[model samples]
Target: MNVMEIRNTLGASVLCAVMFIGITALPATLAADDDAPARETATAEPPDPRLVSRGKRLYVFCRACHATEEVKGSKIGPNLAGILNRPAASLEDSLYSDALRQQDFVWDEEKLDTWLLRPATLVPGTSMAFVGLPQEANRTAIIAYLKTL
Candidate 1:
């Protein structure tokens, strides 16, 4: 091949290699990293089955006060059937503390994590009696289960 032909072939080969690497590595780069902070996003994809299963088990702790089913009605806490993305203290029937009512924030995964870590810290004077889930894994599992509700 002539010099120009060799150069053209080499350039095309390099381009193909770069494209292949990007395509193959893209998913890996996007894969969930456990250490990364959790984010709440509306997604068409189904929740992770393993995470959901673990979360369901962890949710037993929350079941005493929070009812996930609307038909069950509000227990000690408001009906949490659709709590994710909901604004704080939006439930009219469920009496909320002034601390929670005065605030203006949506319940997203990150906020929920912080809340689960320590409700008192998140909202002082709030009525939630349970101390908090100290373990990050437990909190994550419980949050995952709550999302499914």
Candidate 2:
């Protein structure tokens, strides 16, 4: 082929390759926006402020044993700062009762509610000796407060 023809063909091939790459990358760029729908649906309901406030007051009891900080060895109980999203008894250094350690549950709202209502009944042989808040409203408030931490 003539030099000019060969050069033209090479340039065209490079342009096509670039265009193909750009097209493929478009989907990845768009994928991030897809999560917006999930987030919107997940966030439709706002948490109750009253419950959260009351729970904050109740959390005074928890502050004695647990802390909310991510730092290690901060308190007598496990650092509860991020307890909402974490699995039960999953804290690193805190010594847990065999019963609590063996439990496979995560600290979701329902589970926390039951646990707050009756700690020993929820998990038999647990080392957390404190009896739960007797009132359902108090327990619910505590759970709400814990979620905010």
Candidate 3:
């Protein structure tokens, strides 16, 4: 496919995700499903290629604050290189909110899902201003893409 075709396909895919997923910014406390609980694994498995592709597309939205590259450095949020097991508020360059700095847990899949569902709710006064990804599929896909980085 040529450039125009690629753009059209990407546009359609984004439209579909937004429309079908019912992606909304609801309060995490309200939308979080305690039962669906993200499972914790000792070692993370490679993400499905298809899911990673979908997640890379979804990550366009997150590029505003978060950076997947180390050389790129921190933007509005911290650089996410090897963030899967990183501690919260540990980045040296970025200024973190008191809410986030107080946290003592590593970023495992379960924690990531919980945090991405609603960042503000997870760390009440976080400096990062993102509302959050409410769709479970979206969260899974994005998390998958993050793993690749």
Candidate 4:
């Protein structure tokens, strides 16, 4: 092969190696950055069946306005398949209240807990109509179920 061709091949190989290393090391690098938002695991260990079952039952209240799966798409609320660690009101298509869209935050467990306890309390003008889950246990179960979705 010509020297120019060899040099180009070597440069391409080096770029690929750097990209691979960067991609593989991303999680560790992100973990060490205190300012970075923590990444949520999508392949977490299976949630307890009992907890999921209870949550599914409790989710009836949510089902009226929300759809969990994407194919079912957004109803009154947005699809929640990957809600955990997601930014508030980030979905491009779904309509959100000014109160919710104006705020900035990721939806972690604590936030979800508070949101479950009281939607309006979390985002005063959120369009969601469900009053709130007064019981912590019920909220926990529902969160667990949501993680599976």
lDDT of 2 by residue, 1-149 (tens): 99999999999999999999999999988897897789988883677999899888888878788777676565667788778868889977888888999989888888888888888989999888788878988988888778777
Q: Give candidate 3 misplaced runs (Cα > 4 Å).
A: 1-44
Q: Write the per-residue lDDT of candidate 1 for residues 113-136, one digit (tens) a residue.
A: 999999989999999988899999
Name the regions of candidate 1 deviating beyond 4 angstroms.
1-43
Candidate 4 scores a C-alpha RMSD against the true structure in Å of 13.3
Cα lDDT for residue 1, candidate 1: 92
Kindly indicate the candidate among 1 and 4 with the higher TM-score: 1
Q: Give TM-scores for every candidate, taking all chains together and pairing residue i with residue i.
A: 0.70, 0.68, 0.68, 0.68
Relative to the unseen true structure, what is the Cα RMSD of model 2? 10.3
Off by over 4 Å in 4: 1-45
How far off is residue 87 in model 4, in Å? 0.8
Backbone clashes for every candidate come to 0, 2, 0, 0
Q: Show where candidate 2 strays beyond 4 Å.
A: 1-40, 72-74
Compared with the true structure, what per-residue lDDT tens digits does model 4 show for residues 41-87? Answer: 44456689999999999999889788998788788888898998899
Model 2: lowest-lDDT 10 consecutive positions:
68-77
lDDT of 3: 0.84
Model 2 residue 113 distance off true place after TM-score fit, in angstroms: 1.0
Q: What is the lDDT of candidate 1?
A: 0.88
